[model samples]
Target: MIYSIFTALSWGKDLTHLFKRIEESKIALAIFSGKYAQSKWCLNELAKMKTLAEKNKLKVIPIFYKVKVDDVRHQKGEFGHNFWKLARTSSGEEIKQWKEALEFVSYKMGLTLCENRYST
Candidate 1:
């Protein structure tokens, strides 16, 4: 079963709680929006999910929402711009983990929903 942990739905949860949910779940839906790369928490969560998935403890599914897979994988376009901003203040190890996580998640089976698909 695919158990999704939407960040929007987890507004009040603590870090330990969030990590616990990810650890206990079978699948996690990581939605990569235009500004996703800008948030430190989101990137860390993705990194943690990547770590677990690598150990065969969890499965991560990426959702490219109004973003491109290649952009996310290679940190290109707006996503890259935001990531670079975060990278400047982040340690090399953090950037490495985040980048590896993004690259790993980008290659997994997932869905892409462009802006044209929905109106805001």
Candidate 2:
């Protein structure tokens, strides 16, 4: 069976639904794109995944798609800019959690899909 928050019918449900799904998942893939940090939901999910992975309850595999791992980790360049934009509108504690999550993913063994994958 396949399940993902990405496939959720509606987020109108309690946020716990998302947390439950994350807990139920054995493994999770966090895809980091240019605008990834711009979304609070995405950051929150990554935070959850990071927390579970820390406890050995879940395995997280990060995918850096056209975004540098350091950029996500340190919040640099465009990714950082967007993250700061989100931060300005978010709580300090939440931002700290998201930053930790990004840092965790950057050090993990995972896939980095850069541009020109189809090229020589």
* TM per prediction: 0.88, 0.88
lDDT per prediction?
Answer: 0.87, 0.83
Give lDDT tens digits, candidate 1, residues 1-119. Answer: 44464455566777677777778888988988889989888998999999999999998888999888999999999999999999999999999999999999999989889757832
Candidate 2: which stretches are off by over 4 Å?
A: 1-13, 118-120
lDDT of 2 by residue, 1-120 (tens): 112653364366665777787788888888889999899988998898889989998888888889888899899989999999999999999999999999997899888887667211
Worst 10 residues of 1 by lDDT: 1-10
lDDT of 1: 0.87
Each model's number of backbone clashes? 0, 0
- C-alpha displacement of 76 in model 2, angstroms? 0.3
